[model samples]
Target: MVEFAICLPFVITVTMAGAELANYTTTKMRISQLALLVADNASRIGSGSMNAKTISETQINDLLTGAGLQSGRLNLFQNGRVILASLQPSATENKFVVKWQRCRGMQQVTSSYYTATNTTNLNLPVTGDIDGITVKNHLVTPPSKGAVMFVEISYTYQPLVSLQFLPSINQTINDSAALTVRDNRDYTGGTSGIYNAENATRSLCAQYTAT
Candidate 1:
């Protein structure tokens, strides 16, 4: 009976450590996948048209809402942040700019890359190189006259079981993904017509909300 009592604490600690490790790995993967999903979907937005496609505020809201729903039990919007940006090159093609950007989530964070309508150039190379894997490297080179849909996701890890005896393992998770526009998009007006609708809510980066 004494041996059993002594061994119980150790066994419990081991089990908790194992579970925490698993949860951490899964959260990392989910954040990565979420980045990819949002970037891909952003590139595919707007109605299919041979000439060019335009996105509205309503569509952007829907995209963000979809991300929140897909987060499932993670409660992503409530605890994390999502920033979406449309990266386009300058008329000279020598510099890249953030033509437009949108954000959602209650987390108090902003994009590390660029801000909306910023004339600042991106650090990426102007030459075309899309074979890179990491988020920063993926867009090492830019496409001519085309834009890239970039997404950044930041999530705070929530441990399933707190182990007072063990060292704290909490961490802030981050992942990013980018995809070139799949079709021609209309960027002439920037975000001028996005909120043309009477009831569309703009997901401004300055504000944070789960909704």
Candidate 2:
């Protein structure tokens, strides 16, 4: 009976620890896939237009909403953050900069690349980098005059087991993905003027909300 008492606690701790590890791994994978999905979808957004494709504030918000829905029970918007940037080449500067940026989720985290001043073209640019940003050890360079849709997602791990059993496992998980824009887009003024109506609200980087 004494042996059983001592061994039972150890077995339970081991089992719970394993569950926590599994949860962390799954969350990490989900974050990675989410980053890829956002990048891919953002790249395809401006296609199918006869005129120069333009991205709007409403459209970017919709993309963020879609990501929140895809997160399911992960509560990603509540406990995590997503930053999407349009990396473009500055012809005169001979360097790449973040032309525009949008963000969502309640987490108080910003992009690793540059601070976003606005969701539109007037945002502060990141100069001096030939390639816009690095993701998974590779530089995501904008294609010629076109732009690259870059996404970064960060999530705080939610453990399935008690913290007492897995204090170290509950850390932040981060992943990023980038893809060149599929068609010619108006990377000039961002969501200004005709692209975004007067009443539309942009998903500006400063705001932190789940919606």
Candidate 3:
């Protein structure tokens, strides 16, 4: 009886910790899935005609709503500054980019499953910030050469389970995806020169914003 009493606490603690870890893993997967969805949508919008208006907050908000994600709960950042809580077009023409910052927070599990609470703070985490999406038009001066748009999206994820016991666990996970527009269209001549425009566009899309 004495041995059972001494071991009970240890067993309970281990079991509870395992459950917490599992919950964290599930949340991480969800975040990754959401990030990909956001990136794909943003890229598609940016690929529209150069005459098309920049991606608007209303449009992005509508997309989030359609995806069953609360737009108000998301923090959208562009370039390096946090834009509208949802998304709004800036002065930059023919560009639409989005970055997924810290979307999930540490998990808090209680003794009872029914009472457990999981908190997700949309703000950036201390470890680091995730990269945002970059959408740009790949056009050059020569009218004969058609233009194409490109998008690059990146994400930084941290594991909720601490590394104290599980040394094999990775502290962070980083993932990125890139897509180029299929439409071949030419852009109007502008003050911006067209030398190596496509490469420059890709470079801009590759820019990383601090979380």
Q: Give the top-scoring candidate (TM-score).
A: 2
Q: Extract clashing residue pairs from model 2.
A: none
> Each model's RMSD to truth, in Å?
5.0, 2.7, 15.0
Candidate 1 structure quality by residue, lDDT tens digits, 1-211: 9999999999988898888888888989999999998998888887646577877777888888898898899999988999987666755536665666778999999776553333233232322322322355444334766788888999987777864433665478898888898887776643432433446777877778888
Q: Give me candidate 3's TM-score against the actual structure.
A: 0.38
TM-score of each: 0.83, 0.87, 0.38
Candidate 1: Cα lDDT at 93: 39
Q: Write model 3 residue lDDT over 98-133, tens digit each, in one string.
A: 212112112221111011122132221111221223
Winner of 2 and 3 under lDDT = 2
lDDT score for residue 67 of model 3 = 32
- Candidate order by decreasing lDDT: 2, 1, 3
lDDT of 1 at 14: 89
Error of 3 at 43 (Å): 2.7
Cα lDDT, all candidates: 0.73, 0.77, 0.32
